[model samples]
Target: MLDAMIDDDHTAVRASTQDGTYPRPQLLRSAWTDLCGTWSFAYDDADEGIASGWSSAGVSERDIVVPFPPESSASGVGDTGMHRVVWYSRDLTTADLAGAGHAAGRRLLLNFGAVDYRCDVWVDGQLAGSHEGGHTPFALDITGSAREGARIVVRAEDDPLDISQPRGKQDWREHPHAIWYHRTTGIWQPVWLESVPAVHITALRWTADPRAGIVTADIELSVRPTTGTEATISLSFDGRELAAVSAVATDRETTVVIPIAELRNGQSYEELLWSPENPRLLDAEVRVGDDVVYSYLGIRTAHVARGRFWLNDRPYYVRSVLNQGYWPESHLAAPSAEALRDEAELIRSLGFNATRVHQKFEDPRFLLAADQLGLLVWGEAPGTYTFTPTAIERTTREWLEVVRRDMSHPSIVTWVPLNESWGVQHIAADPRMQHFARSLVSLTKALDPTRPVVSNDGWEQVDTDVVAIHDYEWRPDVVRQRYATDADIRRLIDSVGPAGRALILSGDVSEAPVMLTEFGGISFDTSAADGAWGYSSATSPDDFAERFEGLMAAVHASEALAGFCYTQLADTLQETNGLVTDERTPKIPVDRIRAAIVGHHAN
Candidate 1:
């Protein structure tokens, strides 16, 4: 139903990246085949698959849908128990490869949007590749082994009780409890195959400096180019050519800076600048050898200026909601690409310009939706529950990959490396934890200096650009009085915060941009489940509206705050504190909820 609300251009982009279509929006190629359907699945709980030669002679215990975890109902294999090792096998016909444009001189690449924890890919009984990290994309070249009737076998190992791994809100318990939801094990995203030339483009990155009229294009190739190999990059907007540049590529990677004359005009450049008000995207066509990539970029910048969040060099208010990005049916994997686009539109309809993708590196399709719909995003990494060397190493390694994979998206305005000190719980006095947090912030900044980085969000902050606090004071008067002035906010910052921990464990955040990142989690579910709850509760719809309006009014009128993010966008499992239900139906009317968010009156 939300699809009808999207405009013609947005609808076009949404339709192109639908489920079983192109999963990667940042770097898209036409020659691709969706590998999402029924796959033979088996659980290797006894961990005897490797010794039993399951990869060579695949096991078929049951059939499960590709891209949905076995723990989810959508997968048709709703096994929620602890099955550390799971195997998936699918046969690819020669027709599939040929349809994907595979040829003699081309490379046939198997890609996974994401597979939880760790996985090993076997093509026709030969190990093709292996990847760790549940939240990032990976590809394997199966050109040599993949043939007619080739059997592709995948084994995924995800320890359900591994608190050291960054699992986000996935409950380590056998059953869902509290705010944590059911586990998402094994392949929880799209799987596809792509064919390209041997020396094809592997990755594409875009960095836009709207004020300088320059856009930097970094292109990575499958292999280093020959002596005279060249790459051409063309940029266009609204059916008009803006800039084009070609450069010789002798190495695997090549960087080109193209200046757009239209973006240089001080008076009319605003038309081209990307913002929540104008989500104009510049089209890009990149060519390297016989390979081509179709991509796009938004000319925008995000920074903190004078203790205020600035977008495109102008101060902007961030009305955001904490979106955990969960579904009752599919868990982490979205029901469809159309559902992801509809999500952004729904958030925008409620009058929020941004969403804090809480505790998870969301699917790229959601980020694509945010980009297309002018909805800002705060990209965050899923946190580990325990602090250990493995935890630190794993968190750091995956966080870097997350940043690199998503840095080019203009919708992401901030990067939160740590949240609520999940892994580094004793960061207040532990030097190692503090150092790790600081290092994550520094590393994020080193990688992407364009966006503000939150070293640790919520409380126990060390060094952060945004002083984000999570205060769920249900009393509207207390909320209004606490953040009513600069002095009050500073006092709260210096002392214990709403989360009962020191807001600032180390720095002088006197000048940092302040925001109430989390609050107003009022539970009001008419058909509440057994464990459904919230930080606060409202009895009826009228009571819910009153409490929501009161808290929002105080937050919106606060002069000391740069922005605020409500507890959630939609209900996630037992967490019934969402503006909308898990089905995405607003508990209150859409217009009234929008009025509460933007300080406007409902008709």
Candidate 2:
């Protein structure tokens, strides 16, 4: 595509805000306004816009499509240059959300899905709040700031020199390199306004156990309610209530465990088991006084046992793909929610059970689609490549926040805090690095003990529930010889350090479930493209198929190996190794690739 055709790729982009879909499916509310669409924007090149009183200024001549960042053409401001700071302003009114009606008894709050780096928000000329971290959700109570007509201004700062921010695959250089793409500044996700009762449910957590016939829910309120405020919880399937209970809101948090199995009257129901074949979710509703929220949870279990991934106490093989979560027009921002749903469908159609969201913290809407569509995910943290105390502090804080934000999603099965030693490269030799890796594992387990935590995904093997590796050895014989047996896996890991590669040595690889986390990046450039490369280049389409099939078969035949993750699902800037092109067209029919990988499905 030519530079003149940038808008050609942006056609039919998903307007997430206007789509009326619940941004957070786990917690749904009926009253909200989509603060998306056109907004006034300007660049703060010297970081002097605030000093120049830009926040109080009227809309500028420049208009940027909101939600999409400046780096994306979809935003109408495709400036990929070094942007350290930027400003956005928009207008809203109380009447936009029923000013004196339902909102009169409620508090108006401003919510941001995500903002890259650091951002300060202003509402009606008053400071609302500020948030750090580019990959988590944050909100500000703007009830006091809302008026008949209100002005919202946002000041976002992204320093390429700041090594503390966890920016995944966002190149800090003047231009993109190798696998890195352009950087995103300001809001890369949907911004909206929500109205809630004065005392409402602030958060909800669900943990479902199929074998135990139990599902536990933890509810956090905005405040400790007085005597009259009580929370009523109900569970149902297909709108038929199975259980209902009420608890007084004396404290800010409440825990409720419902016995889902009791509905069967001591009978085993095979359909209750959730899996990729049959993804079932139970409907739940929470009501606190005038506040009502709806959510859902899939009844299932995920664990690692006997050196294999066990789902519902059965061995589950993960045929995953590395989804970088980029777009031709939007870059880091998704074009639409339906587009994300379509992408998930494409991945599932290729017979992949899981996706490793490599480096980037993928949009939550995609995870919501995964939960509804039955695709597993390995949630990873994006971090600075260089190691420092600042990087350590930033990664720890943001990673914990990410876990807190995403732990409710039933699709995510693993928590990968670091990938391929980007931030903590010296973890193999340095004692402090080793301790941090262990601490990350502990922190992940302490918060979300349900999911398996891989200390470092690709090469390093230090205190991890899953021992995964990134081997691009295209030769089938070498892959078979290297990981054919438990003994061979250990030898290959021990040989990694002496061979001048980075592999931290601590726990034995033989004790944990082994997976070829990354492999088979068969580059097939139809355009005979310049700078398009992968682990190996295929001379022809036939060659690509044979090479891909050979590599996949060798790994699948390895009885000692639990699973494998393909290099990628779709190609990104200059990387022609995906199963599909950057335009999202298939390089080869997915049926052929699925047959090559898994041979047959349940059908």
Model 1 residue 572 lDDT score: 86
lDDT of all the models against the reference?
0.88, 0.80
TM-score of each: 0.96, 0.93
Question: Best candidate per lDDT, number?
Answer: 1
Alpha carbon RMSD to native, model 1: 3.2
List, residue by residue over 321-365, the lDDT tens digit for candidate 1.
Answer: 999899889988898888888899999999899999888889898
Candidate 1, number of clashes: 0
- Residue 581 local lDDT, model 2: 85
* TM-score of candidate 1 to 2 decimals: 0.96
Rate residue 215 of model 1 by lDDT.
96
Angstrom error at residue 500, model 1:
1.3
